[model samples]
Target: MVKDLVCTLKSARKREICCSRTTRAIIIDEPTPGLKSIFHIIILDQRSGKAEVQYQHDYVGISTCIGFNANPVINFSGVFGTNAFALGTDVAFDTASGNLAKYNAGLSFSTADLIAFLTLNDKFDTLIASYYHTVSPLTSIVVGAELTHSFSTNENTLTIGTQHALDPLTVVKARVNNFGKASALIQHEWRPKSLFTISAEVDTRAIEKSAKVGLALALKS
Candidate 1:
């Protein structure tokens, strides 16, 4: 059977802006022995009255994930009020050398208004491909690249990442980008469906000005 992964944030506050309550509801939760699928709807509303004029924005999104036999997962989600759409799929299988490999492809699209949305003229703006390989029981590596293009501008990036199991309860991941940026994440499994993580990033081009660190604790049911 499928288990709930995590709880969504209910409320957030900023220095000058006050956000309304965020809500999420599960629309579908069909579970099988080796297959699991879930669909959720989320609503977010924010308003600001600190300034002379008030400002507000509302967004609604539906997201879904499907997994079969714990491999070849497919995911697709779109935000309506935000004017964005995304879809992706990943598949894993055993290679001829007895190694495991997974491949992924994803596409994202956006539009200026709901009327012009999903049209072929200016819909898709980004495409990505990711490949992962398990070299050993304790080590795995991933290489991915993405391309973003429009009528007037284009950008591309490539990333190489690896994960190593330090012990039964610890895992480390590091990744490097073509744009002189690198990041590392270390996670410790405190218990079932609970973990602690430390993530950090550094920029080689501007070491002092572009360094960041974060810590997170997560619990899932």
Candidate 2:
């Protein structure tokens, strides 16, 4: 699993100080076979806002994250096993409101050549499934779909997309949903770390509508 944390601090006064500190400890070191756990604590103080504390824990097959400033929120996520088939769930609880704010679960199967995943998100109101396959050493494909149900509107929407790699440095992707909107993009790496991309979107139901086009370039130093 990969986790990213970002902190932003803004202050109008030049004399204000913004700082952060992180502490980590191994709480359990192989208490039993194949079992270990650690704790991480992060403290951030911004000049313009209150101090915030974040906690994270990781075990052999489980992980947890928690953050609180005034309203505390706790999150727990865990993967069951260390095999090709994996199951995981992410749940968030709001301590101030005494309710579960978010919950999501997923099951995935992976192999050397293929990966498949099915997930329930948005408090179980949304369902998503995806498949990825490596056709050859230099070519691969991916397909994914998302279905969402609105409780208030009593409506449903589905979107599906696929991506294909033409070569080591070029790729094309397209997606369309139950709606009339269709979009496609092609990206190519012109240099070792530079990329150019062209994308277009059109409403298929409205043949006379003008298509939207976009271009992007990225470079790395």
lDDT of each: 0.50, 0.69
Model 2: lowest-lDDT 10 consecutive positions: 11-20
lDDT tens readout by residue for model 2, 4-102? 333533333112122334332334444456554443344434433332233222323555555545776777776764557878888889989999999
- True lDDT of residue 38, candidate 2: 42
TM-score for all predictions? 0.43, 0.68
At residue 50, give the lDDT of candidate 2. 33
Collision count for each candidate, in order: 0, 0
List residue ranges in candidate 1 displaced over 4 A.
1-122, 139-152
lDDT of 2: 0.69
